[model samples]
Target: MAWYATGTVAVTNGSNVVTGTGTQFITNIKSGDIFIALDNGLLYEVDQIVSATQLTLKREYAGVTNASAVYEIVPTTSNLKTLAQQVTDLIAIYQEIPQSATDAQDAAAAAQGYRDTAKTYQDNAAASASTASGAATTAQGYRDTAKTYQDNAAASASAAATSKSGADTAKSGADSAKAAADASAALAGNWAAQASGTVDGANYSAKYYAMQAAASAASIALPVPITSGGTGATTAAAARTALGVPAIASSNTFSASQTISYSQPLFSINDTSGTGVAVLQFNSNGSMVWQLQKTSASDLNVRRYVSGAFVDVPLSVSNSTGVATLAQRPMFGTATPWDSANLPSVSGRLLNIQVFTSSGTYTPTAGTTKVIVKSVGGGGAGGSTAATSAGQSAVGAGGSSAGYAEVLLTAGFSGVTVTVGAGGTPGAAGANSGNAGGTTSFGTIISCPGGSGGAGGNPSAAAAVNPSAGVVAPTISSGTIINALAGQPAPNALVLVPGSVAISGYGGSGPLGVGGQGRQTTGAGIVGAGYGVGGAGATTSASGAAQIGGAGRQGVLIVYEFA
Candidate 1:
């Protein structure tokens, strides 16, 4: 009946060793305890059991703490005998050992006791061999487990070293990038001021402020260094240049201005001595040509030139109409129908005459009269007279005065007139008389007069005048009339005067200064009443009617002499 058990199986938490086994196997094996043999002298450490044949064991240790090799054991004679031999040998060695080598002696004795106890418990000498064998097997398992722990620790150490090296490299790269960025920011601040030299100082200061602001705002990273002297360094340089620190005065509006002058030549009237009439005439087959020259205060006047000679036409004033005219004034140089005196200043005239500013020269409108004048008929007297008894003492109603004026085209004229119509007189004390019509005048254009009001009955009053006032001066284009004329009564119809001249004329009024009619052909007039009476004699280009003399109609052109 040989039996064997595992040797020195000690259980432990990873920290402390438990010293009892089989129940107390590794700490002190009983002599007859069953033990199995193995390659190494160390015993096994069995900590937990899973089933009858299974246990958790530690291997690779001196007294059996480590457990990597774990195996199941069955009792048998051959196995028992093998374990017994081990115990016998150990017991002999312990007894023979020196007392000075006490630890060695004790260790050997412990091994022998374990073998004997296992054999005794089974009560078989054969059990001694089996028990010793089991102890040997357990020792080998502990040794294997210890070896595994050592190997794992060595691997972990190696991995840590590798990771540390990688971390060092990454940190170095990050530091380098930060350094580069700092250097770039400093450089940008220095260079920004340099490019602004092209602009003036005041402008440069403004730009400099802007550049400083932009530089202050940015915090770019430095580039990572590469072993190959790599792409990163070049890319970083390009980025630095792109900061585009604007020039101090780059945004200024660049420009300038200049001064100019204009001039014109003045002409003088000149005359020569010698011929007195320094006039020469030529006839090329009935073609008449004349030239005249005269002496004047300023220079020799070349009055008129024809064929090849100069002619003179003396200047004189006429008393009849108070107008100055040459009987047969010969054409001057280049057959100029008009003179510079008649035209406006050269610049103003050119500006007006020419439709376009740059090109397209214009000659004045042909055959168009630049100046015209006209007259309106006088209002009838308020009271009538039996022609025979008419006397200076008789305070007969006062007659209304006639309306007259002239028109002329200055530079700004555009076929428009400034001539305003005249106002007719009101009725007199005891009679009804027709009112005078308003007359028209022209300067740059034609004008129309106002119509007159009708006369009253019984002890009749004069008609109203067409226009109540004198002609107004021409205004700029599109002239505005401050006041308009009142119209005339019926029966004593209005008449309009006509001539080649441009003028506006109003019609004559009825009794007691009735309002006159308006006419674009001549002028417009109004009539008067009550104390306002029209004068006696009235005449128009078209007609003359009524028992007593009606107010005169307006004329196309009324020429008057001023005293």
Candidate 2:
């Protein structure tokens, strides 16, 4: 039959027995059939079929024991046989073949013929060896003759190379002698060309030019002409007049009120040391009217004569950086100069800050005339849930955030009483609601109310339960409140069946603070962050275990004083 895999089988390690649970081995299996275990993909030959649910393998099972595993039974065919039996059958078939006397005689005749052919080949090989010996002797004599010829050829080649080397040496010597002769002839021709020039010609000899230069240097003319790059005068004053330029003097005194004018720079004063000062002065009737001076390498100053001495002007300039510094402030576009006390101060400058975390008094700083006050009420705490049994869960709702208020106080503001609100207390574990927060006030000028607490959750055993409701926004009341904002409400809590995830509610947010986070699994609630922020709710899934809710944050008041 075809391969049979009707049901699963179980086999043990190092055991030859296989047990089938839902299989029919006795009807489908036999000896020599292949047994295949699907779990380890191993095959074994079936040794015996014990029953409809059991069989035996030829060898022990190699793989680990499997209680239930798929298997296949491949039935043996008639063509299949053992290796030893096939070899025994082949030998029996060979023995059945018979031999005769005539066949034996034919075989002996063939052996005799082969022996005679081998003898003939041996005789022919001996004759060839003798011929090879004779040929080797002749080859040796020829080799000796060729060796003598090679020696004679080598000697002749050596003599020819010696002669070629000598000839090359002679040629090199002749080339050097010719080069020397040519150089000497070129030197003699250059000397003859140089000496051929006469003293009166344009191209004169070097010695002739040297003698002429010596004679000219012996005596120069007393008054050199200007065209020849000379001053054309012997004295300094005469030279100045001839050159059409003024004479220079270290110091001069004029009695006739003389005036000097020039189209270019009249005079230049240079300092060897960089730190030296240079001054230019203007005089009227021998009294200095104004003076300009370079005080340093980078600084310049201008002064006007006053009384008996020169007083500094209010203007100065830096030559290096090109920056100008004015001693006095300049008036712009016909505008009057500003008085020291009437000048405008910087805008939005902060002078001081006052903070109130509890009930206290607020006094303005010495120079504070205006103040900005901000106030916020306290936040409510989260609710707590009771202990839950198996297959039941309890969750609490988050609390609501507080309200915020801001106002500006000016002019008549003075010492005022301040009140900071305290945060609400969280409810104890075991199904309790949280307390409400307190109100904050800034001397009746600004006031804000606190948020409401969250409600506790009831135990639920269904797949899902409705979440707790969120709190409403708190109210704010005050005088001329510039910014009055209502805080955000709490988020809803989620309740789910047993073995599923459940979540607690998250707190609300305020103007200046953030709310607390929600809880998952089983844990206590998280506390609120910063001022006027709500607390987180508690959640639990453990049997007979209750969790506490988070606490709320306190309120705060701030005052910003400006000049």
Candidate 3:
């Protein structure tokens, strides 16, 4: 019945209810179940089983606020383990038998010794009888021979007397030996009987105690089934098997938990042999891979599988748990362009000014040589839309840039002029190309022509005026040349163009809408293109008044010196 569940925390910060989204993990939980927050390692007991999705906690549910984190459900007490524990205790406490049976064995051994001693005595008695018989025969021979001597002399009579005395002595010794042998045989028989009676009908007292113990051991009933728990006899038998030197059985364990280990790998060569061998490998999940093997008598190589290969892991006092873990982030590679231009090989001073005016002085620091000048003519103003017609909007051309120029000086030049360019002005009602822009100069060192003005917009199918071209770019000494940005084509009235500027530095194109009568004064405006930039063009259908076009913007001159 002992079990555990894994679930995620679904809600937090509630004092009474702890909710979980996991179906199985939260469904079976009852009152008194324990709840744990994995992140903060907080433990709480369930006070009430509120519902399948919720539980009443002993206290406020507080810990990891993240509902997605995990918690473990462990049973406090259950029947599955009880039978095993009870059986184990029985095996330990009542495993021995009584020792009084050893006394019977000692008595039997004593009787055997007595029987052997009696056999020796009987052999001695038989030898004594044979000696007596021989002596009697010798006496008879002496008497017969003496009768023949009596006829010859008195010496025969004396020999017969000596022989008679010897015969009497031999008979007395034979009788004594026979008596001693009989007594020894009788004593041997008594000892043999005593040895045979040592157990005396096999004492039933031991059997009684043994039967009682067996019944007690067998009567146990477990609330749940277990491989190691059953009807008493089966359970006891299983428990007894634990006494054996268990066969290890692959990874099966005998005790509650055991520390497992292996000899560190011996370095003969690279070993790729998998588990049980001292080599690293990836598991089915590509995780939990490591090994320790002996190298020398004392050296161990700890290794792990990494990136589809095996590599050594660091081993020291810290490796007591026999685990080596690794963590890392993803990786990448890249490349960039390489050049000397824009690459700062040497340091220099370059001053920049971009304003709405024209013609300014440029003073280079003492060692100035080459000067790169970039110029942009002002933008032209937009053309104004018609009044009392459709609501029309017009766009203007952006200012043109003279592009760039790198001028080489005759060395140690004192200074040159500086110029800032202007942007185009906005157009108003009734105006077309507002005004022409002023030209800009860099004090003879360089000069920029002004941008052209835009023409007025007309609903009468007339083409709007195009902006004028900027100055022909200044010529430079060497290495770098001058180029001008392109100009925009003239815009027709009622047009649409998004971001119609730049790649050529042109301004936005006009939107397609017109205005009412001139007196109404609400028409779309066009921009002009000069040094202060061209003014914007304007349009109005006012009575008897003509709408004006935008003015062009002013030009600019820029100077740069490098050391």
User: Which scores higher on lDDT, 1 or 2?
Assistant: 2
Best by TM-score: 2
lDDT of 1 at 13: 24
Q: What are the Cα lDDT values of the candidates? A: 0.31, 0.64, 0.40
- Residue 487 Cα positional deviation in candidate 3, in Å, after optimal superposition: 4.0
Candidate 3 segments whose C-alpha is farther than 4 A from its true place: 1-358, 389-413, 419-432, 459-479, 486-490, 494-556
What does candidate 2's lDDT look like per residue over 29-95, in tens digits?
Answer: 7787777776433557799889999999999885557889788875543123222222233223222
> If ranked by lDDT, best first, what sequence of candidates would result?
2, 3, 1
- Candidate 1 regions with alpha-carbon error over 4 angstroms: 1-396, 402-408, 411-431, 438-547, 558-563
TM-score of each: 0.18, 0.41, 0.27
lDDT of 1 by residue, 1-563 (tens): 12234433343323323332334232323222222223211223344333433344443232223343231222211111111122233223221211222333343344344434433433432344444445445545544554454455445555545555655777866555555544554544444433233223434444454454434322211232222222222232332223221222222111222112226323222234533443223234444443222323222222344554545543333334434444342343566343333333222222111111111212344332232222222333222211111111111122333332223343334333323333443343222343444544444333334333333222112222222222222222223333222222233222121222111122223211222322222112222321112333222222111123234322232221111
Q: What's the distance in Å from true for residue 142, model 1?
A: 99
Best by lDDT: 2
